[model samples]
Target: SGMLITGVTTLLLSLLVLALAWWASIRGAQMRSSLPPGPTPLGLLGNLLQLEFGGLDRALMKVAQTLSRNWGPIFTVWLGPRPAVVLCGYAALRDALVLQADTFSGRGAMPVFQRFTRGNGIVFSNGPRWRTLRNFALGTLKEFGMGTRSIEEHIMEEAACLLGEFQATNGTPLDPQRLLDNAVSNVICSAVFGKRYGYEDPEFLRLLELFNDNFRIMSSRWGEVYNIFPSLLDWLPGPHHQIFQNFEELRTFISEQIQQHQETRKFGEPHDFIDCFLDQMDKVLAPQDPESHFQEETLVMTTHNLFFGGTETTSTTLLCLTDSCPAQVQAELDAVVGRARAPCLEDRVRLPYTNAVLHEIQRFISVLPLGLPRALTRDTHLRSHFLPKGTMVIPLLVSAHRDPTQFKDPDCFNPTNFLDERGEFQSNEAFMPFAPGKRMCLGAGLARSEIFLFLTAILQKFHLLPVESPSNIDLTPQCTGLGNVPPAFQLRLMAR
Candidate 1:
């Protein structure tokens, strides 16, 4: 009788699994019917098995490129039961993100971050809340000297401090990750928190570690799985859980800073991002408008958005600068800027080779390769396919970077990709490291300035020497999901 009961139970479970898989397939088909054509999905797994999850970014580009050849540039891929339309190549991305900017402006639900963000912060939020926070943040950032001479001065000051730290290393082979993190983060810190932490500050180091830790976990396979199966992963044990814990700790730190700003800030004279936000809250928040978006929680999340976005990508890009200073770049820098004065933003045009090198680095690395997924604000048609409103769209950014039609050598690290015959820096429409259109990165301008200023400053003062031979240096990302994490490397800095 016990054996009979076990057999019956097993039969029922198998039947249940069959039913669920049938439902998932049928649902996926319906979703794909209205969307562009692509690979057929299997059960709840969708087209997941078809994708290489080990290195998601590269895997995505590979899979998308193949599928695009079959289904055209804009086609659907199933991420579990969820069907996402991928915008491959330069033309498709521009057609959607640039031509139909407002139509593709909605933020797609990234299950990993959506659980924590809950549609609140500037980056993750949509609709009125996003508009409100973004405008406010932009205004506040500008007021705090973003894109101004004042911000350039601030970056230069931080660069000088960075040089001092590098000098202290005394040509010893050292991984400059933390030092770079500190210097890059301090720029955002000055604007947001109104102060900068010392390189050895315990609290500051802990914060940086949390950011690093979360970024790594989020860029891992675990993060990819969590995005697809958040409900299941929530019950299971994994490193992805560390992401939420780190988020909580980061939120706690931000809350503490907000409290400090609240206590210290004087009315009508906003000092930093937090202060300006607090001032806005005072004007906007009232008893009648209880659902105002400018609340304390929003403040924490928006600040978190800026703090994390500002630090991680730029620092990772800096890490990718392991190659010895190119003779041409050094020569251009010497001829135009010279060693007496630091390279300024205006010198970007004067130092074409150096500028080309920076652009090539961003393009080759393609950090944030599969950029933040964009959602359709309304029903739209692209290239004979009709997509419904709220459809998730993955703008395969690396495809644009690697688009052969646009770049001379899409696969290799060649500064000539951005250089004209005259050796002058030329712009490519497909060169979008910050992503493009209405939903572009908030710190795009600041990031460009930081990259140029920081790199030029370092190369002007020191010759970067890799611990390993140039041919052996691995430029592949440590992880390639959320961001292209540069591999760990050490280099000696000999003062020029």
Candidate 2:
């Protein structure tokens, strides 16, 4: 009887503990944003369980499409306990991004963006710092011949090296992704500092490795957690902190390069980005003028941003485009642009069908499915919904590009949308592959030059070999963090 009484008491205590924990979890969900319609949240976990953490891009699109159909172009969803209003389709996105540009000006430094960048860089910084850095980068690119012969020459060099690498492979099956990443990123690196690293360079390899880590970590589900629960994460070591440490090492390397340029001190000729920066630093650091936007901090941050922002994005887009498009694109490209001619921006104009294919790849794959996670600069009204300042806004690029009303089949890979009835190239306003507005890709001109040139260069040399294999290509994008993808795979290069 005594043992039975002890057993009963222990059982009741265990039951009570579980019940209390359950109640706390349920009650923890306090955020009740009635701004727009979305799936119901579950307790303290919120809507996290609703997401397809394994395959994010597909999951996001499915939810976005369903929500848009039911709620129209604007809807709100919980990213954990936090409420975010996502903009569906281009009309809504453009209204928010372009017309209401200033109102959506702030790129609120989420905990992760803040910890990694300290709000120093262009990708994360807001307010006057962002404006100044952006304007300076713009002017610097112009001085460095972003659209002129200089940038063209830099791209051609990288292209030539890439072509040599592919030709050396002699029609073997190889993943051209890393080589392409290195080649494309090296262009920005060369511009920033007057050096083109050899393929085997240890530092260059490490930098690539670091960027890849950031890419995987940035787009993962846990990344969202870190962004939200920074206070908790700060106490313990986590991927967010590790990533920041690694990224700072990258910044340190750039700082060393800047120091070298300063010591050498050749401002008049302006050999590269560093040289130009040194020249500006001289003027900005004058005794007469104390407070300056251009400082060692800005220089390091801007350099870091360019390397971080300019690299992985362009490389990933190209990698996915090649994977998403049919192998026949290579043959079609070969017939249009011969091997004797070098691929240029002009080639994109000449090869209408190839251009169409490229455009479609960009449209269907849509790497930045959510575009950049934006923060409202002020309380604003859109589609009759009120969005308060600091609310996370996602411009839904995937939904807009795949809207059936815009294209015959928004989901299918048809190049006809980019081609006219007469088989000429046509431009669509609906296609904002890089996302639009003030925060649109800073390296737009440079990225365009590289993509068109690199794709044409490869096609001029090799045919993308088709297979008797099953559809290895999944136009479905895999989002590890906030990014989505064309499913991961490799290709074979055959000489035409």
Candidate 3:
């Protein structure tokens, strides 16, 4: 019994000693690493308490704003023990992404991402794989009629079906979100898989709900902690487990689709994303040097990337776009675009109120609030501050969108920011919801087309009726899974 007690005591002491050594090692290196000044970290805890107040992005915005006002464009913060520089304002963001693109070449990978995606997808991979996959996906999108009439026609057909679904709601208060999600998801799914499901499709509905639930749970302190102490979470039980499981469920669905495609192999001439992937596989797999990552694994992850990244972002932005706009935007759409035309991408030029409203929603909503964390590829200087290689740099995208210096009324949901006196859509360089530079969203063009077409379609066919007084619909967004999801609200779709 005495020996047993001694062994337990020794084990505890050893763990404590190792932890101290590990922590000391981290602090000494981080302290020496050349970066701009930041708030002092509290040992292992870092400045987590400060950044995690309400939300990580919100707290980062507050920190970035305060420092940029005093510290200028470039400033640093400690996310746990890791030192992260906050690149605030549009000018600095543009410079880093556009001018100093090579310095910020790598997208920082998080522990949560590693757990969920297994480094198999385009969203996080770096170097040759990332470049190849991104190019391939972009090419695939083009082949599938991303900008052409072929793809636009598919979106138009889906939009028509979506309008019909909304009309069936019979003026009763219906959640515009689900109908909108159905429409948007169908667009991407059709583009990726070469088929679209009905609004009532159970399998498709489950996929939407999985992503929705994952998004909900991912935006909390849980996600922040996952980003930092991912190794520690493996020892303890938590929500991230379920989140990973949900992601796996999604991956499983994607894998099955790939299998179905494989059985009937016509990949050399891809009609959609999956077919394009197969074509890439055949081209890359040479007889002499046959080392290829472009296979079933890549195909599955690519589809997942397209569906997961493409769908929620497009849908959430649409939801926010509607929420931010006044009823008058819809009324104006009805007056100008009218029901007979079937709102098209080209119509945004004539639909001043609608275009302004879309831009405002993107700016205000800020889908990627903290922006994706980027890793410094090499030692670099930004605004006279030295950033060390491998340091996680949080691009203050949310802050930039609403920066007081950049926008006229930064806090308000004013669509006029994007409109001239003539009410024609005039864009500002500062307004970058899809982010900027080399790592900018690959689907930016497709998303723009989708948003323009979807909104135009709905507005043309039906008027956005608010539940009760429309005043009850919340503007406060639900921060989840690295995004700001729209609040729970319903819209009654009155047929035009």
In order of appearance, the predictions have TM-scores of 0.97, 0.87, 0.93
Question: Model 3, stretches more than 4 Å misplaced?
Answer: 1-22, 25-33, 146-149, 320-327
Best of the two (1, 3) by TM-score: 1
Clashes of 1: 0
Candidate 3, after superposition: displacement of residue 434 in Å? 1.1
lDDT of 1: 0.88
Report the number of clashing residue pairs per model.
0, 7, 2
Sorted on TM-score, best first, the list reads 1, 3, 2
Model 2 over residues 134-210: C-alpha lDDT tens digits? 88888988877842248888898899998888888877677776888889888987888877887778999988888
Query: Whole-model lDDT, candidate 2?
Result: 0.74
Q: What do the candidate models score in CA lDDT, each in turn?
A: 0.88, 0.74, 0.76
Among all windows of 10 consecutive residues in model 2, the one with the lowest summed lDDT is 25-34
State how far residue 339 of model 1 sits from its true place (Å).
1.1
Question: Tens digit of lDDT per residue, candidate 1, span 1-496?
Answer: 9999999999999999899899988877777769888887889898899887747667767777666668777878888888888988999999999999999999998988898889989999999989988998888788779523389999999999999999999999999888989999999888888888999999999999999998888889999999998998999998999999999999999999999999998989888888888998999888999999999999999989997888887877666666634666888888888889988999998888888888988998888899999999989888788889999999999999999999987998888888899988899999998889889999999999899999889888988888998889888888889988888888899999
Model 3 vs. true fold: TM: 0.93
Model 3 misses residue 249 by how many Å? 1.5
